[model samples]
Target: MGTIDQTTYTLTCPQCLQTEKKKVLDKGSNYGGSHWQEGVDFSEFDVAWAGGGTSEPVITTAVCKKCNVPPSIVSSYS
Candidate 1:
C-alpha cells in the first residue's frame, strides 16, 4: 500500500531559473464513521475517502517568474 500525502513544492525552472511555489493536495484518508479502522483501505468503501486528488505528474505550462521559461514541463520541483 502507498501512503498519500499533501505536499507543497518550490519549483525552480532551469531555463529562466525562477522559482515559484505551488500547493498540491492529496487527501489520503478521512476521519469518522461507525468506527475508525486502524489499518484499512477506507477509500475502497467510502465515497468521502474517494477523490483524494493528486498533483499532476507533469506540468508543462509552468512559467518562470524571473526570465520565464518557454513552457517547460516540470518533472519535479524541490
Candidate 2:
C-alpha cells in the first residue's frame, strides 16, 4: 500500500572486524511509522571461502572490504 524504504545491511568480519554493505534493499533509516522486525530476514549471496562449510551460516558471498565478513551477519542488523 505504501512505499518501501531502502535498507542497508552492515556486516563485520569476525576475523578482521571489517564492515561491509551486503545489500541495499530499502531506503531511509526511519520506517515512516511502519513496524519492522529487527533483523529477521536475510538475502544470501555468493561470497569468498573462509575455510568453513557452505552451511556454516557464518560465511557469505558479501565480504567486508575491511574485515571481509560474510553475509550471515546481514540479518543481524535488519
Off by over 4 Å in 1: 1-4, 28-57, 70-78
Clashes in each model (backbone N, CA, C under 3 Å)?
0, 9
Worst 10 residues of 2 by lDDT: 49-58
**Best candidate per TM-score, number?**
1
lDDT of each: 0.35, 0.39
Estimate, for each residue in 1-78, the C-alpha lDDT of model 2 and write its tens digit.
242433455555677655555433222234453332222223223353232221222333565454434534554323
Can you give the lDDT of residue 58 in candidate 2? 32
Ten-residue segment with the worst summed lDDT in candidate 1? 39-48
Tens digit of per-residue lDDT, candidate 1, span 1-78: 233443344556676555555444433445521221221121111111222233233232344445545333323322
What TM-score does prediction 2 earn? 0.32
Q: How close is every model to the real structure, measured as TM-score?
A: 0.35, 0.32
